[model samples]
Target: MVRRRLFSVNDHFYQGKPRYFIAECSNYSCFCVHVEGVQNTSCRSYLLFFVSKQRRLFKFIQPRTQLVATQCGVVKRIFFSTGELSGDLQGSILIRALTREALSRNVVVKVRRYISRVVVKSQKTFQLYGLGGSLMKQEGLELLQDTSKISSIGLIEAVPHLWASWSMIQNAIERVIEDPPDIAILIDYVGPNLQLASKLRKIFPGLPIVYYIAPQEWVWGYANQKVPFLLRYVESIGEICDKVYSIFPAEHAYYQRHQIASEYVGHPLFSSDWKKGNETNQKRARESLQLALDAVVIALVPASREQEIRYILPIMAQAAKHIQDQLVDEDVVFIVPCSRDDFRAKIQQQLTRSGVSQFRIYDKTSSSIVIAAANLCIMKSGTVNLEAVAMQVPQLVLYRLSNWSAWLGRNVLGLQIPFIASPNCVEMRLVVPELVQENATAENVSKAALNLLRTKHEQQRMLTDYERIAKVLHCPEGTSRAAKSMFELMQTD
Candidate 1:
């Protein structure tokens, strides 16, 4: 006897309406039947059952497994947590990479806002949502909270935002528990990210947590007393994260020594998105800024944080004035690329007060173009240092903090490192001149900038070092590699 059974195999939305697919199974065969007019609730069950107890005979149904998986909403949901402007930039790139990788795997991805009921409509395979800023949002990251403006560097600088930061952490924990992700990616922004990792591990013990651009705890063990602190930090990371992707080779080795699951993916700055600067780019950048081809351009990149601006921009302005005095015979123009829109008025006021002439401030311009057009970049010691290296632009890196914060970091935290600039750190030597803390004065900055401008040998030596740094960070399509690794991790489970 040929018995028949109807199985509601697939139920999903088409356009704005519900669509269902029914699989009719007999003792001899099984076939799918499209039922657009049927309501999802009208189906008795979603499961497929065999009345003949001859499931091995249903070989044709094996090919439909992929379709069933897709229709059943079996997607890898990735949660990304990042903060600060730099984090936002990195997160945005990673998000795009993730989307592209998913599409290549024949998956559909969707982004859903953390707080809003509305979901971002798309035809991708992964569901991405987390904490980020406008840039990440633009790349289809459903931001839980916008954290681009809530950044601080030092212990003292973070005091005012402590309460708000704590509240954000609590909210993040609550949301994750509500709809736990298949995988969680935590970018830089150490404190909050580390906290989130620890909490998520306890709440969802099996959830895979990956850390990208991890904190530089390995570089902080200058004193013997700090070794324990460094060990503790690395241990916490190992305990919390299932995988850690390091941008620096030395950092990757450090994590490996401590028995952490880590891989060196190189820096995202060296990814395909940013091409190495050449004469063509330099000429175009100069033209875009309306500068003469023969004119010497000095680019100034201050810190992205407000506190950093207060401690650093004024000194940078004064340094620009000093350079102008020394280069009276040369047609020199200073370009200050504002990192944030809100910082423009303050930067303008500081430059005006310093009596610096023949200078222009660009608010909405790409820093890459500014660096490419520059003969020398006087900037803070951060991600921008790596950018300058990528562009082969000679730079003088400087950084400053409030007196109390500086003292606390040096004395209380016992924070000591050989190099602050990213290029020097990667090279394990001072490839670029760094004027930090009290040494970061107008005279020191101007003197260093002028030396690089006047001495071709020194500039060429720096360029050579940049080439070496590039080799160290030479993983092609690094962000895509990172995304592929993430997908592999998801498949493992």
Candidate 2:
């Protein structure tokens, strides 16, 4: 037989046809190729098979397993949890924003959950934790923590001290390091999150931790009680995290001055266009109040929380009463968006006590309905101020802090801008009037409302300025932008 070479093109054949034979090697079921042109092809094949098996069989053969030190990504994790603010609405919205970001990158995000019993409006109730699950499940991401257990602040705190917890965190670190995330963001809460970051650092020193809207370090001068502990924990965070996003620009500047690397992503609220209640919806709300479409409707948002309702709502109710009598055929209504039915009841009780039942307090309608129906708004300053500006509803911003914060604002920070609304801040002028601290009273609020409602040109100018601010803030489809940024950060060395 000619026995033509099984493989083509060989340089070292001494014979006419380079014939090869296959032999089954002894005691084990091993196969060998005999190359006529090459010496001891069986030995070479054996060595080759040995290496292939090693590569296939060994778990630590991957380059990532060889060096844990070079991995540069988020390490250790902590979360801030405060008992007061029910982050449900904010967390729900944020998870939705993050979902779109994760989907485009082809990455599966896993989140855990827990639940806690909290006092809402002085009534005990259980609120869900793990806002990410519902949104994550919709996008087909893997989830870890029990939504019921992860939400409980007390349970998370019991870890390490009361329960065997390091294993869980270590496993999470392993997964993260395997495919390091572009960024690890810790939002809002200062207590638990700071500790979590510190723990992760011990496991993976190279990981970066970004603190979003960090605790009030500037407010306490970086040396006060919890401030020092936070400062130390954040030092490791600064070492690991490439960026820290702050809620207030001034807060960012403060971190910079203190030598922490930080940036201002601007408030996430600014990125949203607070929906102006639909035209039909606004019309329906206006009709319900029995006001002419031409007759200006003003929105009054007092503090919605029970304590706020007790102290601030009556004042606003009084202001509404004042405006109700003066503007004939004009509509003024108190629109209080409540988280629960009980909150609505609490607000109604206050309305009765104040003798302002003539003014309707809306608990069920959309906030945009209130904002769009009204030409002007009177609201307590916080997130609402930003919303008013977004909707182009000219507003009067108001706030009253405890004496200490007020004193710090006056003697220490000396922030140039007094009015908290974004339109006013961007314009560097009082487009909206702010009655803060001692000034947040019914009489002052009413007087300010009169000035704004009566002056047509002033209202128009404020609206124009607000429109400009809105243009400045309308971030281009933040999900894609944020996703791109996140992906790019992950790919970095």
Give lDDT: candidate 1, residue 392.
Answer: 85
Question: Candidate 2: misplaced stretches above 4 Å?
Answer: 1-91, 107-184, 189-208, 213-241, 246-296, 304-307, 328-331, 339-341, 363-365, 402-419, 487-493
> What local lDDT does model 1 show for residue 216?
76
Q: What are the lDDT figures for the candidates, one per model? A: 0.74, 0.47
* Per-prediction tally of clashes: 6, 18
lDDT of 1 at 13: 32
Q: Write candidate 1's Cα lDDT for 168-197 as tens digits.
A: 889988877655576889999888888888
Model 2: how far is 307 from its true place, Å? 4.2
lDDT, candidate 1, equals 0.74
Cα misplacement distance, residue 245 of candidate 2 (Å): 3.7
